[model samples]
Target: MATVTTDPFVGRLVDGRYEVVSKIARGGMATVYLALDRRLDREVALKVMHPHLAEGSDGAEFVSRFRREARAAAGLTHAGVVAVYDQGIDGETSYLTMEYVPGTTLRHVLQDERALAVGRTLELLEEILDALAAAHRKGLVHRDVKPENVLIDSSGHVKVADFGLARAVTEAASTATSTILGTVAYLGPELITSGRCDARTDVYAVGVMAYEMLTGRLPYTGETPLQVAFQHVNSDVPPPSDVEPWLPAELDVLVCALAARTPDDRPVDAGAALTLVRQTRAALDPAVLDRRSVPASSGTAGAVGTAGTDRKSPDSGATAVLASVAAVGAATAGASRAAVDRQAGSPAPAQPDSTPTTVLTGIGPASTAHLVTTSAQGDGVQHTLAMSRGDLAVDGPDDGTPSPRSRRRRAGWWWFVVVLFLAGAAVGASWWFLSGPGAYTAVPGNLVGATQAEAETTLRAVDLRSTVKEAYDDSFPAGTVISTDPPAGGKVRKDGAVNLLVSLGVKMLDVPTGLVGTTADSATAALEAAGFEVGDPVEDYSDNMPAGDVLAVSVPEGSSQPHSTVVQLTVSQGPAPVTVPQVVGLEKEAALKALTDLGLDPSSTDDYSETVAAGLVISQTPENGSEGHRGDKVALVVSLGPPLVEIPNTYGRNVTEAEKMLKDAGFVVEVRHPQGISPLNIVYAQSPEGGAGKTAPKGSTVVVNVF
Candidate 1:
């Protein structure tokens, strides 16, 4: 592996949108980064494939796998699964944008704490299996299930991530390659033996994880990769109780069954596994199986007995030795000869001269010691061992040769080999048996567009069995087949099963009608019946609508709605009217208060009134009993006094001008001419009112003397 210098996407932009922020993690085939989605205004985790992994000869194959797996994962709508938002290639880099989970992986947790409590461990395991169950139902098998692929969020939500190595069980067989898949520690027996995998394989991995969680150790260990792989294919998993006796037997059985050497021997799928786990957890008492109560020796060293004697107990020292061997084998499987030479133990029969010396150290004379060394040569590498007990030396040939005391020491190794061989034979026989009899194949058809009966018929004609899996499809017709397993042209045994995905169709909803102008409660009932959820209704006064009537709805009537749509109603509070209070004879302050109490505004106009006292209400607009709206202005006419009068006499002036002058002087104009007096006609009819000074109302009519 080369050390990454500068970030791969220092200046590159993806789809003219996402800009890489920083490299977050790098795996064997891809690198993940924290990126900014310029369009969505949010942070996203971007996974970019390595150029070699993307464009090499294997690139096309890997890319296809990636697309299929990503699509399947994206289709899942579970809280425990990371959401994939977008996927595309920017130049040479193929990347996927996903929800940025803010937390560490289970690997990080293990690295930090080494192990967790039983409750916490079970909680995390349950979440992981839940995610797997969802994926399995979608026909997605996460080939790579490991601690690093399981992410734990800050809120303690465990999400399964990294479906890059996932395989769609319905796809073509041309996709399967001979290259090793998944972490060796979690790889299932069938997967290691024949490269065959399915939901059961995933169950096996989950079982391995569960075992590790409880024991803080893997069930299998060896000095080489082949050894570990062989163990998966042959060895039976020692019950977790062997390592953690406090773990319930029910849980141990589940884990052990999942790690069974044959797929048939394990649970049917993730669902079955989950059911078993739930049942086991429900039936067992955690307090009775508490780790603190178990003896220290019975906990971590349960598989190894006391006094260093090779006991034949079910949880025996041999099981522990085999597990340790498998672990070491897996770790050194891909290493070079020089690397293998550094491990403990002596050389096997295949190599002798290359074997290294082994030594044991102890604190006291009573302590035991064993020799461990590694041997390497051009042909292969081997493990050698020697045990010394105070001058009693024990050495054995690498090829299971009998030592001086071989009769006793050889029993365990011989038994282990027999178990390994029998397990391998059993798995092979099961596969052969299943392949010949119950195998069935069907061509991939447009399940989404076909009716359920049509899909069943199509599958039946091909001797394939059909199982309808209901799902939501925006594009496919409802009650039709969405897709089929053993894709078109793919071959399966004659009786093999074919799974069909059926569409539930687009969700339909009725439009809430006649909700407008209805009361809040009435509208709520109507909308609820129409498959719409009703929100709180708002009220407002309207001048046109009657009080307490429905004014309008949030969603207009006749609109199609889905279940749970929130509809808001606006109810009318009335025409803003107020009952006018009577203020006809009250004092000015009292009259104003009365008008205000009726939600009406009052203003006063003062005048000199002879009938009413000062500061008293004389009259009011809209008469005192008329109804008015709140905040409406009302004018009050307060009497100041009777009208004042001014008298004027103009007999000699022009008749028209005289009338105007009289009118301007606040006097009533009257013209009277006597025939006899011409010269003094202007003064002939003059009266004492000509110069009269009497108070009257302004602009009031007055009597005038004219000739």
Candidate 2:
């Protein structure tokens, strides 16, 4: 049963182009009416906001938002999305004309059926998500997503409606402290609190709706709308299986993840959510999807049980033939009734009775009414024929004579029977030859794994023709038969062509040459264009490759990979810098070990030092605390003990002579007097004195006594 609406504007015409037929439904924001577009001569649903909502400041603001959002929604074009035809204002009322759909809302369906089968629920949700994906692509957010907004037609095709009405109401209620206009259960936290909306906001609403669809109940309920809104903000949505334990765990995981309290937890948009839903649906067991236990009397027989129309008799052609035969039998019975009327001398036409009726005829007053009538009734297979002995009597037979002509007349019926028999045989033979078993032959044996030549030979052997087509197949080998058109063990007419799908082997695509040294996004696009799929990238430090640039590909360049194969990319983390270790003042062996531990190759050289001990490092190349990569070589100078020198004897020589002798001995010369000494004077005696065969470093300074 449908609700009857009789508003004052039911018979009014708006904008002279739309004629209002009748009000269909009333919602919080507007009343929907079934109207005719006079200009286009098509039916449309006219949603007109209440005049009171267009009066005050809040109402004015709501109407303004309605017009804007309606136009935005109208810009969207998709099969699953309900189209907005026009939006305008007629006098003080704002109305929008949209595609008039003949169907029930998802809310009505849920109310009637309570819960839907897993397959049906997913089917509906997929289409709804597709609609949302289209809107999200166009940068539109359907702030309200609930059962009430989704419409399912007679064919079970879903169309989503009422895209922007909920948000308009929210904007109108902004000034009021105690007002909430849409379904609080499906409202996102941001929409309820700050009236802000984005793609994720719609994702949240869809999650809540999905929960209701799966469990036949909402995740949250409250006495007041505000309480339900609070629940969406504060509480985590329980798993759908909590209400119906038999539900699949995947469904529960998807719902809980989508309905997360924070915006970041949900899918980036409806497109992403749709992908997960399709993947999850493909993994579900057939038994789970096919489960249905509802009774016909429960008002849910056609909801998810029957997909479209009901089945009648086995086929329609047989029913038509039977009906025609019945009609011919009725006409013959009518003629019999007319003949009986003439014999009985009744002028009134005979009428068919509900049951079989009897009619008797009399020739005169002395004659008996021996004509017993049996009416043709029911299926006409069993019918009555009026007959008399006189009707079959012949004039020659009355003379009690057995004439040859009378015998010939008796043989005429036999001739007619023989003709009928021959005619029936001809008809049956023609039917069999043209359309029966003779018209078609059994297809050849399996060709799925056969070679192309072998399959063609088999098909030709069976009196069938063959055509070949090539396609890439991941499983079958190249040039082998993947499948046949009529399929193996199927029927095909003799000489009919069998399309053989020959495998061309796996599809191969080369890696894009321009992918190297490019950003990940650019590389991904290039790879996809080349028919390869981009896999997760691995990060590593490179000495030559810059950071964030592709360092290497899993498949070498110029090599072919199967189409859609995941190609892993290695992105560079820039050069690997090594810390130069401090190796000076340490033992040569210890210094070499320290540098090697720091990933630096160490080499040592022996050097003589006057002040440093032997067997220790004097200095290192590249110095300490300098940047170098791993495996970089470091050169270290080791100290040998101070060089020993021999001193010549100068005690018997003059100051000048002793000074010259000491200076020539590879030692520094100094002049010393008792009080003051001349600048040019030389030493009289050396401090270590007159020692023989002493050697020193070439640049060493020596002191000599001078007078």
Candidate 3:
């Protein structure tokens, strides 16, 4: 059974126009409700920030940031981007309404399909990048990019959601101490180190997602989030072929370049990334693009056709570039190569040599002799790039001869440098304690929206202590910091305490009872008076309840709702009345049944009609279109045929005589020549044959046969 999560905003009108029907979902910053735009009579997804966040001291700032981001996201008009309609505040609740997409998220899809085929992954990524490119073109970056934010609609079309809301892509001015809004698994190296983010950050995240989609597992996993984060900063995201060696070299190059340790190696932005990906896709062979993807954990390596691969595959580091990416993975990588191509202006790349050498270069220090060998390909294109760590590499020939005396000379120089370092360290320590980092350090700001642990870590780094206070918040997740005591960017003495308001989760309310006996207006007023929001009244036909009176009421399962809680009331319209239908000119039985079916009492009276046939209704009381209750009396005058009359004998008589006789008998004369037209104009037979007991209605036609 689904846990009933109560929502206070349900059945409540926001801004006097949007009616909250029910809660749809809750995220880190807001609770989404399926709401009705009363003015437009359409449904929209309404995102409402929890009271703690929206009503905090920084509420104005949060709202301003939210509005700004929403506007930027709204500026993006694309089929793949979720549309933002409006943003506003009602009382203390900050809300943004957007298009309501009905579908499962890409995260859910990944949960079912451990790994998607190459063609399918490429297809999804193309659409995702297409949308991201649009935002990047507008100078907007979706700081958070992951499968969870990708929505697959009912028709299988993709929609990217939570763009600017996650956090706008900003310059790398801040550091990791600020509230990092994206999933840790997909955070870029720049994002992990500095609070700053740009289009490249999104590109990095997309690269991680692509790796996960193709490998069925994250590139890095650790016991703690911090461990994984450490690897993201310090280690290279190995080629996907490391796990599944059958994967093509282009894929390895693509993933490595996007997930490069530094931002500069990756595509400049999502647009650049998209351009690179499109080119790679076009260059990829069909067999490789549509190849079935098996999880790397499956331990199955097979010989199959792949981009620039031999019939039999070689493991990663042999045929493809290792974890290091240098020349490719950028929009300019191709153009730079074209500039050096033997055949200029050609769409296809030039054949360099028979072997492509993928080199691995270490950043910073500690290059402990790592060598990667490459294989020769039939394509005869040798791609070579080499970078050396001059300082870390040993400077000696392979011969076992005694080296020059430079080692001893270098050792003497190192000793002299150490003496100087000791003298400088003594001076540095004196300044470090006196008005330096140890003596006075600013409190780490940017704690709001960060997790409690993360805030504490940041404070610890800045020589400040943290104390957390708990409160209920519908928007912020449990254990999430809702606000900071001194606000972000405030200065404080070293080791000072920075208080935090942490969320205990959303609050639930008591369900309102005894709504069936009161009038709709009474219930609505009472609910509204009790700090609850009233939804539009629902009406239905009821036998016992009087019109405008309450019939039923619906409440959420738990009391997650607080002030502005939604209250739904069902009003009775009383018993439905049936319209009396016209029975005149209808068959007696049909007319009677029609009234009976409508719940009206049907009764008939016998009468002779001159125009209406026998057993047909002539007139009805309480005429057609008049409303009547069930079992209401309906009087119908049924015809008993016109007044019967005797017909004169026309046998062996002139046709004219028979016609005249029928006319005199108050019947219409219709002469027939079944026998044949008689020269004597004699009538051979007549309808009813002028029988003694036979009679017809007055003005009814009579037939006479002439011989």
Q: Judging by TM-score against the true structure, name the best candidate.
A: 1
Question: Quick one: ranking by lDDT, best first?
Answer: 2, 3, 1
Where is model 2 poorest over a 10-residue stretch in terms of lDDT? 320-329
Q: All candidates' TM-scores?
A: 0.47, 0.42, 0.46
TM-score of candidate 1 against the unseen true structure? 0.47
Compose the digit string of candidate 1's lDDT tens values, residues 1-707.
Answer: 11243785754678899988777888765788888899999989888877776554666767776776777678878899888888886677777899888888888777665556666766777788889877876777888888988988888799898764445322323344446645788888877777778888887888788777767777788898788888877767666655544344345455665666667656566655655466455644555333321224233333112121221213212111111211110111111121222222211221224534322212224533332232344221212232334233246678866676765765664454356446545643553345312232335444437899987887777667777788876677789876555334333456566677888876667766766666667777877776676777788988667777789887758877544467778888875778777776678888888887766778998876757766777888878567778778888877665556555555455556666766786655555554543443354333324445734455555433344
**lDDT (10s digit) by residue, model 2, range 399-453:** 7885888767646734543554465456446544554335556556678789999
1 against 3, candidate with superior lDDT: 3
lDDT, residue 136, model 3: 75
Worst 10 residues of 1 by lDDT: 326-335
Q: What is the C-alpha RMSD of each candidate to the true structure, in Å?
A: 16.1, 24.3, 24.4
